[model samples]
Target: MSRSLRRGALAATAIVFSIAALSACGAGNDAQTLGVRPDNAAVSVDDVKIQNAVVITQPTPGVKGPAVVSATVFNNGRQAQTLDAITLPGTSATVKLKPAEGTGPITVPAGGSVVIGGEGNATAVIENGTEAAKNGDAQKVVFKLSRTGDVALEAFVVRGSGYYKGFGPSEVPAPPSATPTASATPGGEHGAEHGGESSPSGEASHASGH
Candidate 1:
């Protein structure tokens, strides 16, 4: 081939290689490249963002007990926000909040964040929860805030094992046992037998003497 023709062929080969490389790079930017998304739930309402929300229960499946919620709340506004309460819809369970700073509402600092049910952090518990939820289930949780109103999300229910070993609800005290009463025994019958009459032999001897 002539020198000019050879140069043109080389340029065409270089262009083909460049196009193939560009296609490969585009394919690499798919969902897998972003890494694995968290298995928990997340939601944003107004200036508040709740992320990685999950309900953790006892490791035993279907066991009736309390469950704890874990999440991080981010406040993007200039003012701090208070987390008032949490609720589980379509269930009889009640959600109780316990702030890490003792007895008060949980506060998400301005332009900062707060963690719920994390180590040494505030807690949100679902009383008598496992009956309405089980491991591997999706439960609807509502977070009531002072400024953002109510933000709801579908949180995943996970067993308190593996990465969530300490996320389960605190130990609940058992109800007191019923005490025994005097009426529960045969005390009345025994008293009647001993007090109502003297011995039969004693009574007969006294009648003979008379």
Candidate 2:
């Protein structure tokens, strides 16, 4: 073979090897998972407060649909705040928050409160606050208030059946057969009966994984 041809072939071989090495490096990087987090993802309870009273309003019973919940985000402090997107305190739980669906990124003004919910029905989603409360996990609505830096409000999930006050570890939730009846009972009675029972027992109350 000609000397010139040999040099050309060597150069081609070198280029092929270099390309292969780069490709391998790229693949390795791709194989390595990137650190990711949900937006406003910090979940905690130390800094949050019940700025507004935890309220639970029942939809007329037998309404066969996702419950609608509304909460007012008030920045009682002087500074402005931003709410991180909300999440359930469990793995692989599917839920939703209202106002977020229609109004989007709820920005609470300093020393003021904004109603977070959608039209008519507020934000709709399978709620997990009650579940989290029942489980006794850190009960919080993660968000960044204008005044408070990233925070998770000590929250209570208001359900048609009843309410869950989050405080300690996971809760011992009421049974599925009992939830509807439990909620339907008079509010005062329900409170008296399950007043001290706050938490998500980390158990599924229904097939919805709630």
Query: Whole-model lDDT, candidate 1?
Result: 0.70
Candidate 1 lDDT score at position 22: 93
Residue 82 deviation, candidate 2, in Å?
3.1
Q: Model 1 Cα displacement at 143 (Å)?
A: 0.5
- Clash counts for all predictions: 0, 33
lDDT of 1 at 94: 85
Error of 2 at 37 (Å): 34
110-141, model 2: which lDDT tens digit per residue?
66545444233223244433333332223444
What local lDDT score does residue 145 receive in model 2, on the 0 to 100 scale? 45
| Structural RMSD, model 1 | 22.8
**Model 1 spans with C-alpha error above 4 angstroms:** 1-37, 172-210
